[model samples]
Target: MEFATFILAAQRGYHQSSESVIRNSIEQAVASEQAGFNTAWFAEHHFNNYSLIPSPLMMVAHCAGLTSTIRLGTAVCVLPLY
Candidate 1:
């Protein structure tokens, strides 16, 4: 049986991302992997303040290096559609 979990990756923006925020997000991903999560779901958004993630795919790639067990994916894929 496959259990499920989620880690919300904010749409990185002008101010949403600082060194600390990035580091913390990475840490959270690592922790989610260690905790037996099935996937780390990220979302893509355009220029806006509601969310902070523009390149959700890039986020998946980046987090892929930090964890080895869990999978990474995009949830609400808005960037490519619009």
Candidate 2:
């Protein structure tokens, strides 16, 4: 038997990342397929100092390019907040 799991990614804050952090996250997503994740979620935010991910869809697209099995979505994309 097996249980499905979501692989969540974050732009929790811009201060938490650098050039390598961004590229590494995508690599991590690709690796998640081997770890058995069925989906991936990205955080969406704007005007926040830490979270620089403005578009969840773009994250989804990037993840889609990296992984073959995981579906991508927004974990908490507050429209009014962005």
Could you say which candidate leads in TM-score? 1
Per residue, candidate 2 scores C-alpha lDDT tens digits across 7-75 of 343455556564555575666667767788776666665665445556777777877877777666777
> What lDDT tens digits, residue by residue, belong to model 1 across residues 1-82?
7655554544356665545555666687778889888777876656654445666677789989888889888776764465
Candidate 1: list runs displaced more than 4 Å. Answer: 1-3, 10-19, 79-82
Model 2 residue 2 distance off true place after TM-score fit, in angstroms: 6.8
Residue 71 displacement (Å), model 2:
1.5
Judge candidate 2 against the unseen true structure and give its global Cα lDDT, from 0 to 1: 0.63
**Can you give the TM-score per candidate against the true fold?**
0.69, 0.65
Backbone clashes in each candidate structure, one number apiece? 4, 3
